[model samples]
Target: MPYPPDVERWRELVSAYFAPEDVNKALWVILHESGGNSNAIGDSGSSLGLFQLNINGLGAGLSEQTRFTPSENIRQAAIHVATTNNWTPWGEGALFRGEPFGSLGNKPYPGDKKNEFAEDTVAIPGQPAPPVINLEDIDEEGFELFSPSGENFEGQFDGYTSNLEFAEKRILNLVLEHNLSFDPNQGYGKTTTDELGDPVFTLHEEANMWSEVFFRSEQGLERISALRDSGLTTAGRKSAEAFLDTSILENAAGQKNFDDFRSRIDALAAVENIPIQRATDIASM
Candidate 1:
Protein backbone atom coordinates (compact mmCIF):
# COMPACT_ATOMS: atom_id res chain seq x y z
CA MET A 1 0.00 0.00 0.00
CA PRO A 2 1.16 3.54 -0.62
CA TYR A 3 2.59 5.16 2.49
CA PRO A 4 0.34 7.58 4.33
CA PRO A 5 0.54 11.21 3.19
CA ASP A 6 1.02 12.25 6.79
CA VAL A 7 4.51 10.75 7.29
CA GLU A 8 6.56 13.63 5.91
CA ARG A 9 4.26 16.22 7.36
CA TRP A 10 4.57 14.75 10.83
CA ARG A 11 8.32 14.58 10.55
CA GLU A 12 8.39 18.22 9.53
CA LEU A 13 6.25 19.10 12.48
CA VAL A 14 8.43 17.15 14.90
CA SER A 15 11.63 18.73 13.62
CA ALA A 16 10.19 22.16 14.24
CA TYR A 17 8.98 21.40 17.74
CA PHE A 18 11.95 19.45 19.06
CA ALA A 19 15.73 19.58 18.73
CA PRO A 20 17.16 18.22 15.45
CA GLU A 21 18.74 15.36 17.35
CA ASP A 22 15.28 14.08 18.27
CA VAL A 23 13.79 13.94 14.79
CA ASN A 24 15.87 11.08 13.36
CA LYS A 25 15.63 9.00 16.48
CA ALA A 26 11.91 9.58 16.60
CA LEU A 27 11.60 8.52 13.00
CA TRP A 28 13.64 5.41 13.66
CA VAL A 29 11.36 4.60 16.56
CA ILE A 30 8.44 4.86 14.18
CA LEU A 31 10.24 2.74 11.62
CA HIS A 32 10.78 -0.04 14.13
CA GLU A 33 7.27 0.08 15.56
CA SER A 34 5.40 0.18 12.26
CA GLY A 35 7.86 -0.65 9.47
CA GLY A 36 6.66 2.68 7.97
CA ASN A 37 3.32 1.05 7.38
CA SER A 38 0.80 3.70 8.29
CA ASN A 39 -1.95 1.14 8.66
CA ALA A 40 0.08 -1.19 10.84
CA ILE A 41 -1.69 -2.28 14.01
CA GLY A 42 0.20 -3.74 16.96
CA ASP A 43 -0.63 -7.21 18.21
CA SER A 44 -1.66 -5.47 21.38
CA GLY A 45 -4.29 -3.89 19.06
CA SER A 46 -4.19 -0.66 21.05
CA SER A 47 -1.12 0.87 19.44
CA LEU A 48 -1.47 2.46 16.00
CA GLY A 49 0.98 2.88 13.12
CA LEU A 50 4.14 5.03 12.57
CA PHE A 51 4.86 5.92 16.17
CA GLN A 52 2.67 3.20 17.59
CA LEU A 53 0.30 5.84 18.88
CA ASN A 54 -2.63 4.86 21.06
CA ILE A 55 -4.92 7.84 20.64
CA ASN A 56 -7.42 6.32 23.06
CA GLY A 57 -5.59 6.91 26.38
CA LEU A 58 -2.99 9.04 24.69
CA GLY A 59 -2.69 12.77 25.12
CA ALA A 60 -5.30 15.26 23.88
CA GLY A 61 -4.36 14.71 20.21
CA LEU A 62 -6.54 12.39 18.13
CA SER A 63 -8.82 9.38 18.50
CA GLU A 64 -8.02 5.69 17.97
CA GLN A 65 -9.29 5.90 14.43
CA THR A 66 -7.10 8.92 13.62
CA ARG A 67 -4.08 7.30 15.25
CA PHE A 68 -3.47 5.23 12.11
CA THR A 69 -2.63 8.39 10.18
CA PRO A 70 1.17 8.26 10.01
CA SER A 71 1.96 11.94 10.31
CA GLU A 72 -0.62 12.58 12.95
CA ASN A 73 0.73 9.68 14.96
CA ILE A 74 4.31 11.00 14.76
CA ARG A 75 3.32 14.54 15.63
CA GLN A 76 1.52 13.52 18.78
CA ALA A 77 4.28 11.18 19.85
CA ALA A 78 7.01 13.75 19.27
CA ILE A 79 5.12 16.41 21.18
CA HIS A 80 4.62 13.98 24.03
CA VAL A 81 8.25 12.89 24.07
CA ALA A 82 9.34 16.54 23.94
CA THR A 83 7.80 17.04 27.35
CA THR A 84 10.03 14.39 28.87
CA ASN A 85 13.26 12.63 27.97
CA ASN A 86 11.71 9.33 28.98
CA TRP A 87 12.07 6.72 26.25
CA THR A 88 9.87 4.27 28.12
CA PRO A 89 7.39 5.49 25.54
CA TRP A 90 9.39 3.07 23.38
CA GLY A 91 8.92 0.15 25.76
CA GLU A 92 11.63 -2.53 25.61
CA GLY A 93 12.76 -1.28 22.21
CA ALA A 94 14.43 1.66 23.95
CA LEU A 95 16.68 -0.79 25.77
CA PHE A 96 17.61 -2.65 22.59
CA ARG A 97 18.35 -0.41 19.62
CA GLY A 98 19.35 -2.12 16.37
CA GLU A 99 18.21 -2.43 12.78
CA PRO A 100 14.57 -1.61 11.95
CA PHE A 101 14.93 1.24 14.46
CA GLY A 102 18.14 2.40 12.78
CA SER A 103 21.03 3.95 14.78
CA LEU A 104 20.22 4.67 18.36
CA GLY A 105 19.09 8.28 18.27
CA ASN A 106 20.30 10.69 20.90
CA LYS A 107 18.08 11.68 23.80
CA PRO A 108 15.98 14.77 23.01
CA TYR A 109 15.41 16.25 26.42
CA PRO A 110 17.66 18.36 28.65
CA GLY A 111 17.95 15.54 31.15
CA ASP A 112 19.16 12.83 28.77
CA LYS A 113 22.70 11.57 29.22
CA LYS A 114 24.14 13.86 26.57
CA ASN A 115 22.29 16.94 27.69
CA GLU A 116 23.12 16.18 31.30
CA PHE A 117 26.78 16.00 30.43
CA ALA A 118 26.53 19.18 28.40
CA GLU A 119 24.95 20.93 31.31
CA ASP A 120 27.56 19.63 33.72
CA THR A 121 30.42 20.57 31.43
CA VAL A 122 29.31 23.04 28.74
CA ALA A 123 26.76 25.48 30.07
CA ILE A 124 28.19 28.91 30.88
CA PRO A 125 26.21 30.86 33.44
CA GLY A 126 26.79 34.23 31.79
CA GLN A 127 27.94 33.25 28.32
CA PRO A 128 26.98 30.93 25.50
CA ALA A 129 28.55 27.46 25.18
CA PRO A 130 31.11 26.69 22.50
CA PRO A 131 30.42 24.18 19.75
CA VAL A 132 29.61 20.73 21.05
CA ILE A 133 31.87 17.78 20.20
CA ASN A 134 31.10 14.07 20.17
CA LEU A 135 33.16 11.05 21.02
CA GLU A 136 32.61 10.09 17.38
CA ASP A 137 34.54 13.21 16.35
CA ILE A 138 37.64 11.69 17.93
CA ASP A 139 39.36 8.34 17.72
CA GLU A 140 40.72 5.91 20.33
CA GLU A 141 44.10 7.64 19.91
CA GLY A 142 42.60 11.00 21.02
CA PHE A 143 42.81 12.60 17.60
CA GLU A 144 39.96 14.81 16.42
CA LEU A 145 38.44 13.20 13.37
CA PHE A 146 35.87 14.04 10.74
CA SER A 147 35.21 10.55 9.38
CA PRO A 148 34.69 7.17 11.00
CA SER A 149 36.86 5.13 8.64
CA GLY A 150 39.90 5.55 10.94
CA GLU A 151 42.82 7.38 9.31
CA ASN A 152 41.35 6.70 5.90
CA PHE A 153 38.50 9.22 6.22
CA GLU A 154 38.05 12.03 3.75
CA GLY A 155 40.73 14.74 3.35
CA GLN A 156 44.30 14.39 4.69
CA PHE A 157 44.17 14.28 8.50
CA ASP A 158 47.83 13.31 8.73
CA GLY A 159 48.79 16.03 6.27
CA TYR A 160 47.10 18.61 8.42
CA THR A 161 48.47 17.10 11.64
CA SER A 162 51.26 19.53 12.50
CA ASN A 163 49.12 22.64 12.26
CA LEU A 164 45.95 20.76 13.14
CA GLU A 165 47.42 19.15 16.21
CA PHE A 166 48.96 22.36 17.44
CA ALA A 167 45.66 24.15 17.02
CA GLU A 168 43.86 21.30 18.72
CA LYS A 169 46.13 21.50 21.71
CA ARG A 170 45.65 25.23 22.07
CA ILE A 171 41.86 25.12 21.70
CA LEU A 172 41.57 22.15 24.03
CA ASN A 173 43.64 23.92 26.60
CA LEU A 174 41.45 26.97 26.16
CA VAL A 175 38.31 24.92 26.63
CA LEU A 176 39.54 23.11 29.72
CA GLU A 177 41.25 26.02 31.42
CA HIS A 178 38.27 28.27 30.78
CA ASN A 179 35.67 25.55 31.56
CA LEU A 180 34.20 25.61 28.08
CA SER A 181 31.79 22.95 26.90
CA PHE A 182 33.07 19.95 24.91
CA ASP A 183 29.91 17.94 25.30
CA PRO A 184 29.29 15.71 22.27
CA ASN A 185 25.53 15.73 22.61
CA GLN A 186 24.48 19.32 22.52
CA GLY A 187 21.26 18.43 20.69
CA TYR A 188 23.13 18.93 17.42
CA GLY A 189 23.70 17.03 14.13
CA LYS A 190 19.99 16.95 13.41
CA THR A 191 18.27 18.09 10.21
CA THR A 192 17.82 21.81 9.49
CA THR A 193 14.60 22.15 11.45
CA ASP A 194 16.01 21.31 14.86
CA GLU A 195 17.35 23.89 17.32
CA LEU A 196 21.17 23.98 17.30
CA GLY A 197 22.11 24.61 20.91
CA ASP A 198 25.76 25.59 20.46
CA PRO A 199 27.80 26.31 17.35
CA VAL A 200 29.00 23.14 15.55
CA PHE A 201 30.36 22.40 12.11
CA THR A 202 29.01 19.65 9.92
CA LEU A 203 32.47 18.26 9.21
CA HIS A 204 35.56 17.40 11.26
CA GLU A 205 37.90 19.16 8.85
CA GLU A 206 35.96 22.39 9.07
CA ALA A 207 36.21 22.24 12.84
CA ASN A 208 39.96 21.87 12.53
CA MET A 209 40.23 24.94 10.37
CA TRP A 210 38.31 26.92 12.91
CA SER A 211 40.79 25.88 15.61
CA GLU A 212 43.76 26.76 13.39
CA VAL A 213 42.74 30.41 13.24
CA PHE A 214 42.95 30.76 16.99
CA PHE A 215 46.38 29.15 17.21
CA ARG A 216 47.82 31.41 14.55
CA SER A 217 46.49 34.48 16.26
CA GLU A 218 48.08 33.40 19.54
CA GLN A 219 51.40 33.07 17.74
CA GLY A 220 51.03 36.56 16.31
CA LEU A 221 50.52 38.03 19.76
CA GLU A 222 53.60 36.19 21.00
CA ARG A 223 55.67 37.81 18.26
CA ILE A 224 54.60 41.29 19.34
CA SER A 225 55.52 40.49 22.93
CA ALA A 226 58.93 39.26 21.84
CA LEU A 227 59.86 42.47 20.02
CA ARG A 228 59.03 44.44 23.17
CA ASP A 229 61.28 42.24 25.33
CA SER A 230 64.26 42.23 22.92
CA GLY A 231 67.03 44.69 23.83
CA LEU A 232 67.07 46.39 20.42
CA THR A 233 67.40 50.08 19.50
CA THR A 234 64.19 52.11 19.76
CA ALA A 235 63.84 52.43 15.97
CA GLY A 236 64.27 48.66 15.52
CA ARG A 237 61.59 47.75 18.09
CA LYS A 238 59.16 50.27 16.61
CA SER A 239 59.80 48.93 13.10
CA ALA A 240 59.16 45.38 14.28
CA GLU A 241 56.00 46.39 16.14
CA ALA A 242 54.66 48.35 13.19
CA PHE A 243 55.36 45.41 10.93
CA LEU A 244 54.00 42.61 13.17
CA ASP A 245 51.47 44.16 15.50
CA THR A 246 47.77 43.32 16.14
CA SER A 247 46.91 44.25 12.57
CA ILE A 248 48.95 41.37 11.25
CA LEU A 249 47.14 39.03 13.58
CA GLU A 250 43.64 40.33 12.80
CA ASN A 251 43.89 40.65 9.04
CA ALA A 252 43.16 37.78 6.67
CA ALA A 253 46.21 35.53 6.83
CA GLY A 254 48.34 34.98 3.73
CA GLN A 255 52.00 34.84 2.69
CA LYS A 256 52.20 38.53 3.33
CA ASN A 257 52.00 38.10 7.11
CA PHE A 258 54.78 35.56 6.98
CA ASP A 259 56.96 37.82 4.84
CA ASP A 260 56.37 40.78 7.07
CA PHE A 261 56.92 38.84 10.30
CA ARG A 262 60.15 37.37 8.95
CA SER A 263 61.30 40.82 7.83
CA ARG A 264 60.63 42.25 11.26
CA ILE A 265 62.67 39.45 12.83
CA ASP A 266 65.52 40.16 10.42
CA ALA A 267 65.54 43.85 11.29
CA LEU A 268 65.59 43.08 15.00
CA ALA A 269 68.45 40.63 14.49
CA ALA A 270 70.50 43.18 12.51
CA VAL A 271 69.98 45.91 15.12
CA GLU A 272 70.88 43.60 18.03
CA ASN A 273 73.88 42.14 16.12
CA ILE A 274 72.54 38.60 16.75
CA PRO A 275 72.13 35.77 14.23
CA ILE A 276 68.79 35.97 12.44
CA GLN A 277 68.18 32.32 13.39
CA ARG A 278 68.69 33.06 17.09
CA ALA A 279 66.50 36.17 16.97
CA THR A 280 63.75 34.27 15.13
CA ASP A 281 64.04 31.42 17.59
CA ILE A 282 63.71 33.73 20.57
CA ALA A 283 60.58 35.38 19.12
CA SER A 284 59.07 31.93 18.44
CA MET A 285 59.29 31.23 22.15
Candidate 2:
Protein backbone atom coordinates (compact mmCIF):
# COMPACT_ATOMS: atom_id res chain seq x y z
CA MET A 1 0.00 0.00 0.00
CA PRO A 2 1.25 3.47 -0.90
CA TYR A 3 1.99 5.66 2.09
CA PRO A 4 -0.59 8.37 2.74
CA PRO A 5 0.45 11.72 1.27
CA ASP A 6 -1.17 13.30 4.31
CA VAL A 7 1.09 11.29 6.58
CA GLU A 8 2.35 14.45 8.24
CA ARG A 9 -1.20 15.54 9.07
CA TRP A 10 -1.90 12.08 10.41
CA ARG A 11 1.27 12.30 12.45
CA GLU A 12 0.25 15.69 13.89
CA LEU A 13 -3.22 14.48 14.74
CA VAL A 14 -1.89 11.39 16.45
CA SER A 15 0.81 13.34 18.23
CA ALA A 16 -1.72 15.87 19.51
CA TYR A 17 -3.88 13.07 20.84
CA PHE A 18 -0.96 11.18 22.33
CA ALA A 19 2.80 11.79 22.76
CA PRO A 20 4.02 14.41 20.34
CA GLU A 21 7.73 13.79 20.75
CA ASP A 22 7.72 10.01 20.33
CA VAL A 23 4.99 9.79 17.69
CA ASN A 24 7.46 10.14 14.85
CA LYS A 25 9.38 7.06 15.86
CA ALA A 26 6.20 5.13 16.61
CA LEU A 27 4.81 6.15 13.23
CA TRP A 28 8.07 5.13 11.57
CA VAL A 29 7.95 1.70 13.17
CA ILE A 30 4.23 1.19 12.60
CA LEU A 31 4.59 2.28 9.00
CA HIS A 32 7.42 -0.17 8.59
CA GLU A 33 5.25 -2.96 9.99
CA SER A 34 1.79 -2.21 8.63
CA GLY A 35 2.52 0.03 5.64
CA GLY A 36 0.71 2.89 7.45
CA ASN A 37 -2.63 1.21 6.91
CA SER A 38 -5.03 0.11 9.60
CA ASN A 39 -5.28 -3.66 9.51
CA ALA A 40 -8.60 -5.02 8.29
CA ILE A 41 -10.90 -5.87 11.18
CA GLY A 42 -11.42 -9.39 9.88
CA ASP A 43 -7.79 -10.10 8.94
CA SER A 44 -6.66 -10.63 12.55
CA GLY A 45 -10.11 -11.17 14.11
CA SER A 46 -9.29 -9.67 17.49
CA SER A 47 -6.79 -7.17 16.07
CA LEU A 48 -7.85 -3.77 14.74
CA GLY A 49 -6.46 -0.29 13.97
CA LEU A 50 -3.04 0.76 12.71
CA PHE A 51 -1.13 -0.97 15.47
CA GLN A 52 -3.41 -3.99 15.46
CA LEU A 53 -5.03 -3.28 18.84
CA ASN A 54 -7.05 -6.05 20.40
CA ILE A 55 -10.63 -4.86 20.94
CA ASN A 56 -10.61 -6.15 24.50
CA GLY A 57 -7.75 -3.85 25.49
CA LEU A 58 -8.54 -0.65 23.69
CA GLY A 59 -7.35 1.35 26.63
CA ALA A 60 -6.40 4.20 24.32
CA GLY A 61 -10.02 5.36 24.53
CA LEU A 62 -10.57 4.63 20.85
CA SER A 63 -13.87 3.13 19.83
CA GLU A 64 -13.77 0.00 17.69
CA GLN A 65 -15.98 1.67 15.10
CA THR A 66 -13.42 4.44 14.54
CA ARG A 67 -10.47 2.05 14.57
CA PHE A 68 -9.71 2.64 10.91
CA THR A 69 -9.83 6.44 11.05
CA PRO A 70 -6.30 7.76 10.73
CA SER A 71 -6.62 10.10 13.69
CA GLU A 72 -8.28 7.50 15.89
CA ASN A 73 -5.81 4.83 14.84
CA ILE A 74 -2.87 7.05 15.71
CA ARG A 75 -4.40 8.04 19.04
CA GLN A 76 -4.92 4.41 20.01
CA ALA A 77 -1.45 3.52 18.81
CA ALA A 78 0.11 6.30 20.87
CA ILE A 79 -1.83 5.26 23.97
CA HIS A 80 -0.71 1.69 23.38
CA VAL A 81 2.88 2.91 23.23
CA ALA A 82 2.43 4.82 26.50
CA THR A 83 0.85 1.86 28.27
CA THR A 84 3.15 -0.87 26.95
CA ASN A 85 6.48 0.97 27.01
CA ASN A 86 5.74 3.91 29.30
CA TRP A 87 6.66 6.17 26.38
CA THR A 88 8.04 9.29 28.03
CA PRO A 89 10.94 11.35 26.77
CA TRP A 90 12.74 10.65 30.04
CA GLY A 91 12.39 6.85 29.92
CA GLU A 92 13.09 5.82 26.30
CA GLY A 93 16.31 3.95 27.01
CA ALA A 94 14.72 1.53 29.43
CA LEU A 95 11.65 1.18 27.26
CA PHE A 96 13.56 -0.12 24.21
CA ARG A 97 16.39 -2.61 23.88
CA GLY A 98 18.63 -3.33 20.90
CA GLU A 99 17.92 -6.62 19.16
CA PRO A 100 19.52 -8.68 16.39
CA PHE A 101 19.22 -7.22 12.89
CA GLY A 102 16.71 -9.78 11.65
CA SER A 103 14.73 -10.15 14.88
CA LEU A 104 11.95 -7.79 13.67
CA GLY A 105 11.66 -9.77 10.41
CA ASN A 106 13.12 -8.89 6.97
CA LYS A 107 9.80 -8.73 5.15
CA PRO A 108 10.10 -4.94 4.54
CA TYR A 109 12.85 -5.84 2.04
CA PRO A 110 15.70 -5.80 4.51
CA GLY A 111 18.89 -5.09 2.59
CA ASP A 112 21.88 -2.88 3.42
CA LYS A 113 22.94 -3.20 7.05
CA LYS A 114 23.17 0.58 7.48
CA ASN A 115 19.64 1.06 6.15
CA GLU A 116 18.09 -2.08 7.62
CA PHE A 117 17.21 -1.79 11.34
CA ALA A 118 15.65 -3.77 14.14
CA GLU A 119 12.36 -2.74 15.71
CA ASP A 120 14.01 -1.46 18.89
CA THR A 121 16.76 0.41 17.03
CA VAL A 122 14.49 3.39 16.40
CA ALA A 123 14.77 6.34 18.80
CA ILE A 124 12.59 9.21 19.97
CA PRO A 125 14.17 12.63 19.47
CA GLY A 126 13.92 15.54 21.96
CA GLN A 127 15.52 16.72 25.17
CA PRO A 128 15.41 14.40 28.19
CA ALA A 129 13.87 11.65 26.12
CA PRO A 130 11.51 9.29 27.91
CA PRO A 131 13.18 7.49 30.75
CA VAL A 132 14.03 3.83 30.50
CA ILE A 133 11.32 1.72 32.12
CA ASN A 134 11.79 2.00 35.88
CA LEU A 135 9.80 0.29 38.59
CA GLU A 136 9.56 3.63 40.37
CA ASP A 137 7.66 5.10 37.43
CA ILE A 138 5.02 2.38 37.61
CA ASP A 139 2.48 2.21 40.41
CA GLU A 140 2.00 -1.51 40.75
CA GLU A 141 1.32 -1.51 44.48
CA GLY A 142 -2.36 -1.65 45.36
CA PHE A 143 -1.89 1.00 48.03
CA GLU A 144 -3.75 4.21 47.20
CA LEU A 145 -3.09 7.47 48.98
CA PHE A 146 -6.04 9.07 50.74
CA SER A 147 -7.42 11.66 48.35
CA PRO A 148 -10.35 13.79 49.42
CA SER A 149 -13.23 13.72 46.95
CA GLY A 150 -15.38 16.31 48.68
CA GLU A 151 -14.91 19.98 49.40
CA ASN A 152 -12.69 20.45 52.44
CA PHE A 153 -9.96 22.82 53.54
CA GLU A 154 -7.75 21.96 50.58
CA GLY A 155 -10.64 21.78 48.15
CA GLN A 156 -11.94 25.18 49.22
CA PHE A 157 -8.62 26.75 48.26
CA ASP A 158 -8.01 24.82 45.05
CA GLY A 159 -7.39 27.16 42.11
CA TYR A 160 -7.17 30.00 44.57
CA THR A 161 -4.95 32.99 43.83
CA SER A 162 -1.27 32.13 43.42
CA ASN A 163 -0.12 34.91 45.76
CA LEU A 164 1.98 33.57 48.61
CA GLU A 165 0.65 36.21 50.97
CA PHE A 166 -2.93 35.16 50.22
CA ALA A 167 -1.99 31.52 50.69
CA GLU A 168 -0.33 32.34 53.98
CA LYS A 169 -3.37 34.17 55.25
CA ARG A 170 -5.62 31.29 54.27
CA ILE A 171 -3.39 28.75 56.02
CA LEU A 172 -3.13 30.87 59.15
CA ASN A 173 -6.83 31.49 59.23
CA LEU A 174 -7.65 27.86 58.65
CA VAL A 175 -5.35 26.77 61.43
CA LEU A 176 -6.70 29.33 63.91
CA GLU A 177 -10.34 28.83 62.92
CA HIS A 178 -10.04 25.07 63.24
CA ASN A 179 -7.99 25.39 66.43
CA LEU A 180 -5.18 23.54 64.76
CA SER A 181 -1.78 23.82 66.51
CA PHE A 182 0.54 25.89 64.30
CA ASP A 183 3.23 28.37 65.30
CA PRO A 184 2.72 32.01 64.43
CA ASN A 185 6.38 33.11 64.71
CA GLN A 186 7.52 31.13 61.70
CA GLY A 187 5.92 33.63 59.32
CA TYR A 188 4.21 32.87 55.98
CA GLY A 189 7.37 32.45 53.95
CA LYS A 190 7.68 29.88 51.14
CA THR A 191 8.72 27.32 53.69
CA THR A 192 5.90 26.22 55.95
CA THR A 193 7.27 25.94 59.48
CA ASP A 194 5.50 24.37 62.44
CA GLU A 195 6.52 27.63 64.14
CA LEU A 196 2.93 28.68 63.57
CA GLY A 197 2.53 26.77 66.82
CA ASP A 198 0.57 24.22 64.83
CA PRO A 199 1.48 20.72 63.74
CA VAL A 200 -0.80 21.04 60.72
CA PHE A 201 1.65 23.21 58.77
CA THR A 202 5.05 21.60 59.13
CA LEU A 203 7.99 22.26 56.83
CA HIS A 204 6.82 19.61 54.41
CA GLU A 205 3.28 20.83 54.75
CA GLU A 206 4.38 24.38 53.92
CA ALA A 207 6.20 23.19 50.82
CA ASN A 208 3.17 21.26 49.60
CA MET A 209 0.87 24.24 50.19
CA TRP A 210 3.20 26.54 48.27
CA SER A 211 3.33 24.02 45.44
CA GLU A 212 -0.43 23.88 45.31
CA VAL A 213 -0.65 27.67 45.36
CA PHE A 214 1.81 28.02 42.50
CA PHE A 215 0.20 25.28 40.45
CA ARG A 216 -3.25 26.76 40.78
CA SER A 217 -2.71 30.50 40.32
CA GLU A 218 -1.35 32.97 37.76
CA GLN A 219 -0.36 35.45 40.46
CA GLY A 220 2.50 33.13 41.36
CA LEU A 221 4.71 34.68 38.73
CA GLU A 222 3.95 38.22 39.78
CA ARG A 223 4.58 37.25 43.39
CA ILE A 224 7.96 35.83 42.49
CA SER A 225 8.84 38.94 40.50
CA ALA A 226 7.80 41.08 43.43
CA LEU A 227 9.88 38.92 45.73
CA ARG A 228 12.91 39.30 43.45
CA ASP A 229 12.41 43.07 43.28
CA SER A 230 12.35 43.13 47.06
CA GLY A 231 15.67 41.17 47.11
CA LEU A 232 13.99 38.10 48.52
CA THR A 233 15.38 34.60 48.09
CA THR A 234 15.11 33.05 44.61
CA ALA A 235 14.75 29.52 45.86
CA GLY A 236 11.41 28.86 44.14
CA ARG A 237 11.56 31.59 41.51
CA LYS A 238 12.66 29.32 38.68
CA SER A 239 9.47 27.24 38.67
CA ALA A 240 7.28 30.32 39.22
CA GLU A 241 8.94 32.08 36.30
CA ALA A 242 8.63 29.06 34.04
CA PHE A 243 4.99 28.57 34.93
CA LEU A 244 4.21 32.22 34.26
CA ASP A 245 5.88 32.10 30.87
CA THR A 246 4.54 28.79 29.62
CA SER A 247 1.38 27.93 31.52
CA ILE A 248 -2.05 29.03 30.32
CA LEU A 249 -4.76 30.43 32.53
CA GLU A 250 -8.43 30.12 31.71
CA ASN A 251 -11.78 31.56 32.80
CA ALA A 252 -14.90 29.71 33.93
CA ALA A 253 -15.84 28.84 30.35
CA GLY A 254 -12.34 27.53 29.62
CA GLN A 255 -11.42 30.60 27.54
CA LYS A 256 -7.67 31.17 27.74
CA ASN A 257 -6.73 34.53 29.24
CA PHE A 258 -3.03 34.32 28.48
CA ASP A 259 -3.42 35.41 24.87
CA ASP A 260 -5.49 38.33 25.98
CA PHE A 261 -2.88 39.23 28.55
CA ARG A 262 -0.18 38.94 25.92
CA SER A 263 -2.11 41.18 23.57
CA ARG A 264 -2.43 43.77 26.30
CA ILE A 265 1.26 43.51 26.97
CA ASP A 266 1.96 43.93 23.28
CA ALA A 267 -0.31 46.94 23.10
CA LEU A 268 1.44 48.50 26.05
CA ALA A 269 4.71 47.83 24.31
CA ALA A 270 3.47 49.44 21.14
CA VAL A 271 2.12 52.55 22.82
CA GLU A 272 4.03 55.61 21.59
CA ASN A 273 6.22 53.16 19.64
CA ILE A 274 8.05 52.23 22.84
CA PRO A 275 10.55 49.39 22.47
CA ILE A 276 9.33 46.05 23.77
CA GLN A 277 12.08 45.88 26.36
CA ARG A 278 11.21 49.30 27.73
CA ALA A 279 7.51 48.44 27.74
CA THR A 280 8.18 45.18 29.57
CA ASP A 281 10.30 47.05 32.10
CA ILE A 282 7.55 49.56 32.69
CA ALA A 283 4.88 46.90 32.92
CA SER A 284 6.91 44.83 35.36
CA MET A 285 6.48 47.61 37.87
RMSD of each: 23.1, 19.5
Q: Work out how many backbone clashes candidate 2 has.
A: 23
- Cα error, residue 200 of model 2, in Å, equals 63
**TM-score of every prediction relative to native:** 0.28, 0.28
For candidate 2, give the lDDT: 0.37
lDDT per residue (tens digit) for residues 152-188 in model 1: 3222223245434444444433333333332233211
lDDT assessment of candidate 1: 0.42
lDDT of each: 0.42, 0.37
Question: Ten consecutive residues with minimal summed lDDT in candidate 2?
Answer: 142-151
Tens digits of lDDT, candidate 2, 1-285: 323542333453343434434656665544543444443342435445445454655523444445544434554555445556543321223323321223332122212211111111112233222112221211122111111111111222222332433443444344334433322233223323375655354333442343234233444344334334433223333344345445433221122333433344445457547667755643332
Candidate 2 ranges with C-alpha deviation above 4 Å: 1-9, 56-63, 83-285
